[model samples]
Target: MNKSTFNTASAIALAAAALAGPAVAQQATAVEEVIVTAQRSSQNLQQVPLAVTGYSGAFLERSKIEDFNDLRTRTPSLTFEQFAPGQPRYTIRGIGGGGGVAVFVDDVYMGQPSMSSVEFVDLERVEVLRGPQGTLFGRNATGGAIAFFTEKPGSDYRVKAKATVGNYDLKSVSALISGPVSDVLSAKISVIAREHSGYAFNETTGRDIEDETLAAARAALRFRPNDDWDIQLNIDGSTRRGTAPWWDLMIEAPKSAGKSNPEPRRGRNHTDDGYADIDNAGVSLNANWDSPIGTFTSITAFRNTQSHNRANTTGLLVAPLSDVANRRVNFHTLFIQQADQKAEQFSQELRLAADLGDRFKWIGGLYYYQDDGVANRLTDYRFYGFGPTPVDGRYAYASTNETKAFAAFMSGTFALTEQLKLQAGIRWSHDEKDHTTVASGKNFSGFRDGGVSVPGYSAASSADWSAWTPTASINYQVTPDVFVYGTISRGFKSGGFSDGDSEKQSILRPFNPEFVWNYETGARTEWFDRRLRVNATAFYMDYTDLQVSVFTQLAPNLPAVLVSGNAGKAKIKGFELEWNAVPIEGLNLYGNYTRTESEISALISGANNLAGKKIPRAPENKFFMGASLARDFGGMTATGRVDYTYQSDYFSSINNVPSERVLAQENWDAGLTMGPAGGAWSVEVWGKNLANELHVVSISDILGDAFANYAPPRTYGVTLSYRH
Candidate 1:
């Protein structure tokens, strides 16, 4: 069925079911409770003033959220775009891109967008906090924050394992084991591995693209020496090898054309080599002490990563450049390129929490972060000039980027009365970064001295930034089950390098930091004897110094350049509504809707004018609905669930080009489980994108053509899991 027909039918069915649900009540049972740590303390989700979503480990597995992309459809006011494995950019409420959002595991920030794309394992829960989180998370959280809480070792021994096989030679294995090792020590270990053949075929090489192979492991240990002291250590590593997203000539255009054109369902044609590999490792230590006055906690961590990528953009640049230059770009072609990158980081945090009598509660923390990174890129250029002399140039560049940051933060809540409360938070942060770039070009044309000549150049630049952000909120409780609150918060995002061939021309120039002031009001209420819940939030953001990437050609001989510039000012406003209901025992229903609108009011500086343009990737409207039912029959139990998602059209590029626009899409998924309650084994069958819709989720324009990356096709799989 078509999307419109399916949507109409589904809506009618859901409405009917909801209307008839309350009358058929089974054994009375309260809705499941959700706990979250969005405010740096454990609290019931309903008590939090911010717009947040929390999911337990069981929920994650049942929903088949194996990676970050899977999260895009499940959450409201959030979107994800992936250029490749380990390379993802997020847009939250029209405020994201260029590392604007932050992801953390146990309060330790991943530091980079690429590093945050790793697989999750043995997780206790996942929480997504919407809106600015600058008061506590600091820089890079101008949009929002996502936190992954890993499961800790328990005193009881436990083991869980699962394996799966699917089409396209897809294979996966995962296991987790936990137990007490000694009287005072407990440990947990988890590992996951996956391999899959590609889905797209490359006619040029007669091979499949988009294949993936990955493995990851984590080990954790906990020590409780006394009633007042607790310590925990965790170490993890991951390695992956995957073919990068291949650009195809989706829209067949003449070599003389430069503008991008839209073409749906284009065929794949990767004529050149393309690949990516990554290796990452990290270790963390946490300690806590319970004292009479409060609880003191410390966290320290170190991480490292090495990666390499090689791809060909011949059609996008070399071919067009050669055609425009009216020169013979050699048969071997001068377009293949490779980049190698390495990074190392260390961080430490100290925090204290106390309940000061019954009138006030406070939490404070100090944090430090340091990182060092190096990247090297090499390019081959070959084009024959007028005199049989080709510009066979071997160009190489290396860059080093380093950063150091420190911060202090504190938050408190005061009870003014039995029904009124006031909360405030403040943070002071300082950051500094140094960047150095060295570049050289060697022309092997054999016309100018038959030898390599290098006019070597190097440049360095540094920037220091500091910011003080504060947040305040007032919450009122109308009753024991209803809460209303309002808050205003400030956020900041650090800025850095651009894409260019030289330091003076691009990479070394620093852009100003972007900032946002967000105002939000929300309410949480429970109805029908706590069996139904409703939450809503409305927000507005005043954004300034928007960091935008601009493309230009400073000179004919120089390579095309992209620079980070403070280009425009924008305003964003949105509202979210979420509801959950357990009208009858063994049946649960949930749904959410979000509406966001953003506009660029003025263009202060930049290459192109973007006034009156909507921010890219920020869908105007989105909806999600799901239902799950479970029942017992004799000694066996059966459970089933279904979820549907719909998103309005949105642009994928900054220019708001028509060709970069994605049409509205609807996706549906369903699953079933059969087993005894609390049994050691269970069988599950699941299907995703049941309607088999085709839609582009991301696009790249560098290849002289609009190359689109489509969402996954319809997929179904079955699995059997065991636990002891």
Candidate 2:
């Protein structure tokens, strides 16, 4: 993105959040403990022992989170980077997949980033599980896992709704309904719609807009014939439509200029006018049975998504750039292009455990999963102000890949003694990837000069691989509130064909899957009779054959896209602290902080001097703090909370480009919430980026020059939600 667009990233956010409303719908709290079975078992987040984070439906209405990116403010070690235009690659603990993060609903694995859908209304909670989850999850997830739990059928009839309007002509409305159908069955469903007139304008086709409209619904069916068997079925679906283009930088402006760039001739166009439309659907069944020996449970799921769009790659070429010191037009450049992608997949899980008396217990199961799809990219190019020339011309290129994968696994927990538990697991995965590329009628002039492109270009390649992973963990209860645990695990990612210099090695050389050997120990405890809760962990990940994306000026008209294969090692160690304090009744304080040291340990011997270099994009320090006060009146209950998140400086590029960095930035988001003292109805006026702090979330090639993706600026909105 260009500095022009990044400078205004906050304005775009303010305009967007106003129109987007909150992440989900609002309703009365249903479950007291907020149950989540993401690990294939029902467990409270506080009791799970593993590093976990969760947000309930109530939290959404109170905080006013409209998009997944808003989550970055609340969770530690969680990050998101845009993949193409609308899709986002979410990561946890600095361990996200190279291109995207694997997601699951209920128990079904989701593969398509473009069409994936998440709605907050009727949702149970959003769960983020840190570390490699190799033992139970279908595919070998090296980084971590995320799950969205929807509300299921219950015993009572309920109705909920929320409406909001604010900056940039934004409007949002949502509703949900649930009740008992018969003595043995019950159901619940939710619907939401959102709209905004955009905060950006296009220079070519002037329009003040970047609008999004999404409709989502989820239903749960519950049945019970007797006390012995309980079964529930769930279905979810949604479609999102808007002009969410890949807004690249058309101009690099100073931080002072903000989204208010001083450019007028671009015509009927705004930097964010890239257009797209999307749709998605998912279904699953969860059943539980109780017997004398123990309890057995099963979770099955499937999801499908289809997304399409025609994004104007024009921003890449027309972006205006200047030196860091002066806002002078540095160059007049232009290129036009776009890509189309689609993906879909399914998964299932079964868990059975037998309680062998009070002291002995164990559980194990078989897991299987398979995915087949194609990611096809079509690239088209053209020049500005004039027709095609000898040096500049219009062209199209096409590429496709078939991804198929399968895996099976088992794990169990054994009690060694009264206060200690032993956990072990193993898994084997087989993955096949087929890739092909074709470039025709495209003249390559710069390819002859740049060392990165192939001399006499041809378009395709393919490959495949199999992998195995093992893990062990031990938990010792030092006391009632303190526990010490350590785990060592391994995970791998499949290797595929690369179009660029990724082929530096011999063609006969096999593509080695990226591996992560992580070691860690942690503690979870509370002191002063639950007045303070502290969860801390220290971890190190040894990365090998790390898949790295390489960019080069292979084709001036193409903006160079390719990958490179190399063996490199790195160590990422970090400490995280989350705590709560209650010094007095009706008064509470909370704080969370993370400190990490991520660096390059080796860089292919003599190829690069990256050893000891700090990893790009990884911030060294991040902390969030908040305070809440509540006093019970005779007939009503009311409370107010305010929070702020602070992060240190971070690099934007792998090479540690200085000009492209998100410097020490501080963001403060606070909310004033008050309900009918009884907690049945409430209204909240919230301000995010309350200080109007201008900060960048990410920066990439937008036309060129420091293109940045920024956070939303200061804005205040009001929300009124009700439940009965």
The most accurate candidate by TM-score is 1
lDDT, residue 444, candidate 1: 34
The number of clashing residue pairs in model 1 is: 1
Candidate 1 lDDT over 1-724, as tens digits, reads: 1234323332332232221111121332656678999998899998998889888887787777787767878888989986655567887896677878788987788886557856766888999888889887785798898889988887887676666667767766677778899989999878777777775656557677677777777889999988898899999987777766554434432442332223332233435547777888999998999999899999999999887777654323233323445453423223456778889999999999999999999999999999998889877655433234545677677889899999999999999998899999999988899988777776232111122333656768898889888999999998989999999999888877653343344555688888889999999999988899999999999888877764443434333344567755889999999888889887888888999999888764335678888887899999999988888787666778899999999988656766567779899999898776656666788888889887566764432345566666677788666666
True lDDT of residue 6, candidate 2: 26
Quote each prediction's TM-score: 0.87, 0.84
Expressed as tens digits, the lDDT of each residue in 142-163 for candidate 2 is 6777777666667876676776
In terms of lDDT, the best-performing candidate is 1
* lDDT on C-alpha atoms for all candidate structures: 0.75, 0.61
User: Clash number for every model?
Assistant: 1, 28
TM-score of candidate 2 against the unseen true structure: 0.84
